[model samples]
Target: MQNGVVMEETKLEPRVGVAVFVLKGKSVLLGRRRSSIGDSTFALPGGHLEFGENFEECGARELEEETGLKMGKAEYLTVTNTVFLEEPKPAHYVTIFLRAVLADPNQVPQNLEPNKCDGWDWYDWDKLPQPLFWPLEKMVRSGFNPFPSQSHPLHSC
Candidate 1:
């Protein structure tokens, strides 16, 4: 309590989040977040990593949960240490970036969680939507690319 006002005592920890890069040709799948944090901003399909889940498992789960599309497999791309200092509830996250291909090229993406996201859309890497989510914006600023390259190792089955 401060100045006779009761304050909730909550533990703050860096949450582990997975962001999947689902590519189709030159476009990548993105969704507009509708939640309190990063509201109305384009971001990759992903969410927090559940307990007892590996990076790949988390990525696959988030991808399928957020967007109605099944990914073949995901490869580790990079990680971002994000810190939100301006939000009402400041938070930190260790965001793991993964790349994957759609199981079916013709499979369309749908908004599975309307409460958290608006809808899914494919955008070219060079022409992404404005107001990107924090992690994704940081990734672009750091020169991170999701395109398939021979330089980076891929994990596929």
Candidate 2:
């Protein structure tokens, strides 16, 4: 080896994540995450932010990718910096949160990626399902109200 030393091949860098806070009436759209860090926990629709992607674009793309429902232009909501140091492989992510109204009221969320998500469902924001993903849980605990006015849809799935 050069200089009688070895170098690590990989570097640990913080990743950018985007999550959408979609609300249907008093309910918010969330899915059960099947990830290594926060497995079996409920989380908003989101994914990694790709290179050269703006926050809004990344949020929209990830939302549609995770859930078959499309959304109109997104609006900034909040952000969360979470570090999973206790996990087997420590990870860090800066998650930018956005909220968007459903573009198509008829477009129901489908389990497109069953491998990464158990499924999607609508849950009351105040009474969310247990074991929330870290970022989302942090947002909830902060008492942040993304939507001041809740649209109580006459019918929801």
Candidate 3:
């Protein structure tokens, strides 16, 4: 310790996040974020990965919690490294993407957490909503597509 002052270690680590790409026909589910991090931007049904949870488990839990939809089989998509340089909190996240079909084909998406999201809606992949969340924007920019037949080269586990 310099000058007898104790130094505390600063903990700065990339947060692990799980995002679900729920597809219905040629459309994908998206929600308008109302949270402070990415307010007013469209994002997937996702959240931070809880302790002791795998990617699929986290994706299923987040999808149900955020959109009130039952999660079916989730396939691993791709990982995105997101850095929010413009945000007030200045956060970093390593988000794992997963594609899941709804357990019930007729199930509707809802905004279960009003404080964090506005509502869920479906948008065509070729024409997504404006101002996407950082991770999602990155995914789109990298040509990531949930539709396996689109030839994006994403594999399911």
Candidate 4:
């Protein structure tokens, strides 16, 4: 519909994501995005995967970038497939989830990216706050546990 020429809608490709489930004292870290796609929703510390970066590297980088906290060795946890078809700019992402503890338990989290995140807090996985980001909601619905050394964690949320 531009210059009397009919144009077809452009398609969007799925983006890859890496999210870290930072566990501390039986609670996981969650942050509320401010002006981004999933505004007002609680999400983990994560971002788009950069080329040539592994999941652990991406998780650590994103955690530091967003919360100013260093992430310890991240363990492969699970994955989520979420499609934001209801968004103004419908998009899809295949997010890889990783579990990590803080490199230093005494180090507190700070809001490094105020424009993106409101703040960070810890919440129990089973008692997560409402209106979670789609990727996380999907993962929680699947009952994927981030706890360590638990039998049947995959079957228990």
Residue range 1-157, candidate 1, lDDT tens digits: 9999999998888999988999988899999898767888999998899999998888888888878798886788888888887777889989988899988889999888999998999999999999999888878898888887777655762
Rate residue 115 of model 1 by lDDT.
92
Which residue runs does candidate 4 get wrong by more than 4 Å?
1-9, 150-157
Model 2 per-residue lDDT tens digits across residues 65-151: 888788864677767888999777889999888877788867799988999999999998889899998777777798877664547
- The residue-by-residue lDDT of candidate 4 on 1-157, one tens digit each, is 9999999979799999998889897899999988547888999999999999988899999999999999865688888788887877788888988888888987788899989988999998779998898778876787767788765332212
Model 3, position 97, has a per-residue lDDT of 87
Question: Which residue pairs does candidate 3 place in steric collision?
Answer: none
RMSD of each: 1.8, 4.6, 3.2, 3.8
Over the stretch 1-157, how does candidate 3's per-residue lDDT look in tens digits? 6679988866668999998999888899999999768999999999899999999899989998988899876799778787777887778888888997888979998888999998999999999999998778877898877787855533445
Q: lDDT of model 3 at residue 41? A: 96
Q: Which segments of model 1 are wrong by more than 4 Å?
A: 1-6, 151-153
TM-score-based ranking: 1, 4, 3, 2
Q: Report clash pairs, candidate 2.
A: none
Using TM-score as the measure, which candidate wins?
1
What's the lDDT for all of these models?
0.87, 0.82, 0.86, 0.85
Model 2, runs deviating above 4 Å: 1-9, 149-157
For candidate 3, report its TM-score. 0.87
Name the regions of candidate 3 deviating beyond 4 angstroms: 1-10, 150-156
